[model samples]
Target: MNDDVRNIVLGMAAAGLSAALGWLARTCLWNRRLRRKQAFFGLPDNSESVLVVNRDAGSPDLAVHRYDVFALLELSALIKECGANADVITQDAARQGFGERTEFCVGGPGSNRRMAAHMRAMLPGMRVNVDSEPGPDRLAFQIGSERYRLEKGVGEYVVLARLTTGQPGRARPVFLFCGQTAITNQAAARYLYRHHERLARKHGNSTFVLLLKVVNSQAYGPDVTELVADVTRAAQAPLPTTAPARSSHRAP
Candidate 1:
């Protein structure tokens, strides 16, 4: 081959090689970021985890709420993305040993005692209040001075929290996707799965809590959750003497 032709061919090959390497590097960085976000939620690759679903004990058929089921499915998909498989268990069937494993708890304080107890112990500032009267406005979840209530034909609110228990060397991570209503619960789970990477970047591996407002809740389900507040002080703050008082008015 002529010298000029040989030089041109060699340059083209080098450019192609460089492009391939650049693409590979970008892919690797993206995967690394995803893995780091997954790890922040205690979902490590090739790990076994547990999903504790809540069912109403009063129901004879052991029926679960529709939104709870939705949350379970969405969260399961997120776990799979981390290359982990989770064993599904109802709240009644979840035993003491389940606490040792990485867990994702679905439902509100009224339905899931395991998650409620954890919230009380780990995140004492937040509380779920069910109204004594039976009506559409019967439920609300409170955080400190703020109370998020359900308005008929309007919207609802939910809480998403990540916590770690056990010893430092062998900490067991637990995620809480809970709300006053099932719709809100599903919204909370959806928010976490959708924006977990952003959350991981903001908080790193530290424990945190989020309050999300679900707009047009009756129509859109989880597609319209707006961030109402995000709290990161629960892990370091001292426990309060009493839970926040329930407000009779709706959140403004």
Candidate 2:
């Protein structure tokens, strides 16, 4: 072969090799990210999950709020991206036991009976005033010493939690996107989708609860959000117990 031809062929080979190596590197990085996300979400590849939603209060038919519905769509997309199929069910229809499937529950206690049960069972420290009069603070969410009240059009608080089902071994995860309003619920789900990597890094695919604040949502929508607090410990802490009435039936 001529010297010029040999040099050109060698350069082409080097370029092809480099291209292959670069592609391999990119694939490895992408696979690593996908694996991390799957681990944090506890969704095995090609698995099934539940997407529990709340029923609209004022709707004659069983219609959910547009914002909550949008949040559910975002959550559904996220779950699909994470390689799981979600079966969307309403709070009344979500009667399955936990520790079986990965769940993405949206809505506050007042709107979602399943969420209300979760509050009583899993997050006892969280007290939601659902039966109170209709007002800004009607559905106040209190944890520890802080009370989050909804100020319409201005600001609202949402609680996003990635927790276990309180099983003996909490291997399954349930992501809760709960808030005062539907807009805040959407914000909470968006925050989870956008910040799962950061959350996984900090919490390591484990149980965690966060309080997020949405500012001027009427103007900016659910995009303007800030982390108010990490209420993991407080939200899951057991509620205070009263020493029973001297055990009326002790050792009968």
* Stretches > 4 Å off in candidate 1: 56-60, 97-99, 135-137, 166-169, 232-252
- Across 60-179, the per-residue lDDT of candidate 1 in tens digits comes to 677898878898899889888888888999887777542377789888777778777777678877666655677644666556655667774366777788776534436657888877
Q: Quick one: best lDDT, which candidate?
A: 2
Reference-based TM-score of each model: 0.85, 0.90
Q: Would you list the C-alpha lDDT of every candidate in the order shown? A: 0.75, 0.82
Error of 1 at 136 (Å): 8.0
TM-score of 2: 0.90
TM-score leader: 2
Across residues 115-219, which tens digit of lDDT does each residue of candidate 2 receive?
Answer: 888877788878766765676457667775566776766778889988785453355787888897889999999999999899999988667899888898989
What is the Cα-based lDDT of residue 56 in candidate 1? 55
